[model samples]
Target: MNREQPDPPAGGDRIRQTAVRAGGDVIGKKVEHHHPAGPVTALHALPTPPAGFTGRDALLEELLAAVDPTTGADRAGVVVSAVAGMGGVGKTALALAVGAAARQRGWFCAELFVDLRGHTPGAQPVDANAALDTLLRALGVDVEKIPPALEERAAFYRSALAALSDRDEHRRPVLVVADNAAAVEQVRPLLPGPGGHRLLVTSRSTLHSLAGARRIDVDVLTPKAAVALLAAILGADDSRSGRTEELAEVARWCGYLPLALEISAALLVRAPHLDPARLARRLAQEGRRLERLDDGERTVRAVFDLSVQRLTPGQARVFALLGVNPGPDIATEAAAVLTGLEAEEAEEVLQDLAGARLLTSHPGGRWSMHDLLTDHARHHLTHHTGTEVEAARRRLLDHYTRLTADAAIHLQALPGEAVPATFTGTADALAWLDTEFPNLSAAAYAAQHAGHTDIAVALPLDLGVHLDRRRRFDELISLSTLARDTARTTGRTKAEAAAWNNLGAALAGVRRFQEAIEAHTTARTLYQQTGDRHREANAVNSLGAAFLEARRFEEAVQAYTTARTLHQESGDRRREAAAVNSLGLALAGVRRFEEAVQVHTTARALFREAGDRHGEAMALDSLGTGPGGVG
Candidate 1:
């Protein structure tokens, strides 16, 4: 440590001056600056303590990869590693150690630590702007000049950190550590310029949601590391003097948790007269039972419990309900339904949990708790009453009901067909539909079992348009089967007919002509049974299309003629035009061009009268000439 005092600044000069940095650590040099404010929170201490800090080697590699010159055309910019893991798993310890190691290797000019207090549980997370204020003031920025808005504060933080980084690009470098981050959003504001600054963040969960962020998941220290840490704290000579079992027992009892080891060592230091073997026996008796090892008021469980208490009733409900959410991660939309809150509110809650380092957000915006945290949260919220569970299920069902209905209406809109304006948002509704497709199928299946027959039948009908757009014919077929089964169960002839029509369309799109014809024939039977003559004609028309694709013109013409008679009798001009167009094509295929032309001419006239431009265009293209020309 440098013993020389920092040079005193001139009187009345409020702009406290500090070293901007000139690359590489200046050994034994102390930066002279007037800190405009008192230190906010002295970091827990440098990484001088002994800890194994397991599972971070892979994380360090990821961080290095981000700044690897080969990436992004071989340029140099500081790589950001959000060191996230469960509480008491040594995020801060790992970060401090890495910073110290970087300094020893001359990779940085200096290192600074900022605790964002993201995991303080009951305490509100430190605002981004406030963190900036502390950092800027610490770096010699005037306290009164700090920006109030979070965005502006962030800009200033980047600029200030960048100035030091730029100073390092040519000479030495300074790496900054912003630890205990609350969320990606909070950290995003403080990220140094994509230049020389290396940021290492430690949190309780992975920060994979941050684009380009390198994630390091910290777990308990290895037993070897734990023993090493014990020896470091309790004295290596004393530890190895034929009483190693105490250290090993202490390490094991602490779950190899570094923080717990430190506390245990503190206890040992204060009670040196106590026998080591007796201490080991005491710890052993507390097997798997975590005693409150808080130093007066700071215990790991207390820290996490406070955060849990800060969650809303709905958020708390989701945190508990998701204990049973089976998967690696659950999408935001599914989580929203799992909780009773609206999608937006549920998303906000997830953001809160993510910021608090209780959850990890993934690509495509799904989130999950760390394995350790997940297990603990499940244990924490085990008091969910039976009534609460039922209420949650009801909310979930309600959410799916509106979601599926909205999807159905949108599907109807695909052919520019009019559907009721039931849903308030089209974009969000469609996205929800897309993200929840599998869950929707499962829900539909469950609904059918629960006697929600129409819901089971209609959801697939709603998704038909978009799924067709993606050419998911197999999924469409599966959906149609559910609809058909539900309709049969409920004795709903119209729904059954609709299911057949959907099935036929899916089969036709995939060129499964025989299956397509069978589906259409089934739809025709159901439509006729319901006395929906025009619908029956439409089914016949679909069968004609399948036959046409299969090169069965005679069968195609027979189906088209039957459809045309029904359309003409019903005065359904659009259906009449379609039937005529099909009949003409069937005739043309059979080398009867004259009849084909005549039929197409009649179809074109009807399409024009109906004001259907697309239909009229098709009709005009079909005759292949004007009224008097050849087909």
Candidate 2:
């Protein structure tokens, strides 16, 4: 190790004399100054251990093993372990406990701790130069002899640790804890030399840039642990002993986060008459949850406020826009459109936020914020940039609308038909639809809520076929109702007719035949008024199918005959063939066997002409079993 020892005064004087102009003993005399009378013993500057530091038994054991001096002696360098987690998860508490435990185990002869203040409210992080000065002073270097620049000070700090490690009389290492570091740069220079000294850093960020550091991620407490912590804070003789369920509910409202739990516990301790069940009710209201989380001094909101204070302008904009997203998670491309950023730029910003623990990245390249953090982001957007929220939500809805429309083409394709080449195939299209279905459903509702009725109608209309294919009748019914009401309110007659048809199909899927018939009848009437012949034929065909399923053969035959005529007039030969096939089945339903055979033959010819092999095969099968094929 480079022992660049501190040099004495340049004059080679063992003692320096300074004039004392106004002292009680000497008014105009020179006073001699000397170094401390004896050698400086090992320093102890760590804060007191956190009160009621419960749980995390496995994590504590693992961290202790990582820094055990006996195990670290095999390695030539100092051990650097970082504790990273979201704010209010107790990273600092864990670090402090580890430092104290290490000292008690005789793993180190001295302990030093400093708060980097990385996420402290209204405070900037302590720079590396300033941190090194603190560490050097604790290591027995005089303030006057400490170096000026960061590099020199770091070397001096390491050398002092090395000197302590090399001493035959006291060869144990020193335990250093750097708490609340915002970035890796703040703690990099504080690393000790290759002498087995240990450095433990606690931060809201993961600090991935620090090389060779063992990262221990801290998360929220388990439900049992959270309740245990509450009891610990409320004392052993509190009257709320039998109310475990209410206590658990309150913990659930706090999201099992340590800081929120601590604050809630403090509130109960201060107000002895407050009921735990009542507290749970107040926190169950999400709008008032954060308000109740405050104890007149510290708040969950203030803790989150500090986490976002250091974000760049772009990151801040994107973070605020996340509040407007209704889905539980957002894909990268979707977030890009919502934030008006390029896909690549949005990905980088998302990863940065993940590093800062503000967002969590999932397996499919999606990101999500914690429920409490999302509430804070929503409040931030409402107060800081409310004007852009509508635009951002509109952009997100439009993006889903376009993608859903594209996926619908594949869902509507026939068995022997080709889909659009933009999609790989039917399977790929289905996967995209499956992944985005939740977002699309949420977007449709959000559009209606935001008064964008056109998008609200278009989105569910486009998703109708997929919802039917997946047997998601409940979701289909929900969105269809929204679309139907939104269209009627906005005077969109054509969109309303389409929504009615979709609702009819979903109702038919669930065997609600009478309601389905009523929905299709209204749709047919609307199409007739609009002079849309092709859609009128579609509505009539759907009406015939509902009649056939309801076992009303005569009404089915009448609806199919009219539908066939409408399709012929519109020059939709495929739909005409479909109507003819349904007419044959209705003929057999009423026991007209020979008439059914003739009608099936004609339908087979039309299906062959239309190049619909699947329809033609069905027609031939109907011809083979003339009376037996009736519904």
Candidate 3:
């Protein structure tokens, strides 16, 4: 047994030796460890602010206060501020100004800027996912490491922002300026969670649904601010041309809107010696204002067109109608009338327009469009609205004509007048006319140009008495001229006669006696040719007034005599009373006081028969007072 143990021990030694050698071989292999590289530094990726950027100090301060990373130590999420307004209202300019200022103040370690292209003329808006991919690459993340899914990428982006803030020994901040963001979804994923980061978003949309965002609305520049901006753009030499009044006129014509002012200033710079007064004169024409406020690459109208192009079909139709609207602003009820929708339905469309920044809402449920936007809308009305524009124009004009005719009945009525059901009383009628006077004037001209001959003829005919009451003589003349031309083109004989009569009245109001006589003569001939005895009598009365104005007393007497006879034949007692009163004036002009008194006495009786108490009172006063007879 002793001999066997000794032999095994000797064998076990070799095995032990081999095991030791294997252990040594394993221990001999080299060992290695890896660690991640340090974070990137010095990121500066913001576009330069526009040259000569001026104004918006108050807005800049608000933006700076909202986006200041230093003040919100307890806050963890990124601060977001939305700058919104109509296109070309300086939202981008204000945003750029804030970004440049923040960068200069050393408030950020990295900066990012992107144009969302939400309202670009011919391009689609940039996808938020793709925009994130680009942003990740900019932040020094490897392209391969970026996740393929949008949600994953967005998660990774937030992590990266958190990691960057954490890794930085100095605790530097990041700034992002998202330009032209179309909607909330496009910007939601890009925002950083509670951290040392801030976002500034600028858009043509109000972006009201963007959660937790500080909203800033940009409006048209104040007149002084606008003029100063123009001066800044045009330089001291061009702006100080001893034509400050003209410069101010130019600013007003531009609607005190920045894009228009900038474009006009640029035009002035290019032409140098083109007097500001001349430019103002050109812009004074509303039809040509947009044309003059355009450069080759950019235009106020083009900018506004892009904003309109983004509207929904219903919203687009309303926008087009707004362009054709003749007033400075529109109430919800009036807008309803224009769109042929219920007031509530039209109000919803108006809210959509306001949200898109295509229209601005004022107090009292009213809305206004920018001057340039109106021009662009009109352009769309001409090209995009197609045949619907004609129907729309007719509806618009009919609404105005019917309402105005009703109002005229309360103010002053002719024979055979029918009141519109819309008018409840004289006060209501006058209030409507007062509110719609400007639009009524604009509708007449718009109808004439749009080839709505019937509307053109009816609008001025119904609105003329209101215009006369307001002493809007120039506008009256313009409406009358347009109506006359439209009536002639459409071969509406009675409309032509009415147009000529209104034109004669308007011309007389403006002291153009000779032109007034010609217009009245043409009206009389047309009315007589059409065998419209009542209207012919009215035309003859108008001709007699023109003769009296021209000091041709004998011709005035003859015209008034013919008008009185025609009114008697037509059984228009009211107009016969008016003609007799005019005959009394002509007789008085010819120094026949006794004949004037007799004529006035007969006129008073006719006025009473016609139930015109005011006409009777005027005739009584005329009979008592010699030189000032009423007609």
Best by lDDT: 2
Better of 1 and 3 by TM-score: 3
Per residue, candidate 2 scores C-alpha lDDT tens digits across 1-631 of 1100011112221222111111000001111112342323336877666577897788888888877877745332222333343576877778878888887888887788876767643234667876776676567665445555678779888888878677736698877888878888998888785777888888777777887677778878899998888888788899774478888987777677776776566556656787888766655554254565453213465445544555677877788888888766789999999998999999999987775557768767888775556766777786454567888888999888887766666554565454457577666777788777767877888788788888998988777766654535556677788888998888877777777877876676556889978988988888789987767777787787777777788998898899889879978676677678778878888988778888888988998998877667767766655333532
Model 3 Cα shift for residue 146 (angstroms): 75
Q: lDDT tens string, model 3, 216-298? A: 78777777777778788777666454456777887777777676676566556656677777776666544254565444213
Give the C-alpha lDDT of model 2: 0.69
Q: What TM-score, over all chains together, does every model reach?
A: 0.50, 0.56, 0.52
Give the Cα error of residue 500 in candidate 1, in Å.
Answer: 2.2
- The better candidate by lDDT, 2 or 3, is 2
Candidate 2 local lDDT, residue 324: 85
> For model 1, what is the error of residue 577's alpha carbon versus the real structure, in angstroms, after optimal superposition?
2.1
Candidate number that wins on lDDT, 1 or 2: 2
The list of candidate 2 runs beyond 4 A from truth reads 1-293, 296-298, 414-422, 621-627
Residue 39 C-alpha lDDT in model 1: 24
lDDT of 1 by residue, 525-559 (tens): 98889897866777777777777767787897898
Order of the predicted models by lDDT, top scorer first:
2, 3, 1
Q: Give the range where candidate 1 is weakest over 10 consecutive residues by summed lDDT.
A: 19-28
Q: Quick one: best TM-score, which candidate?
A: 2
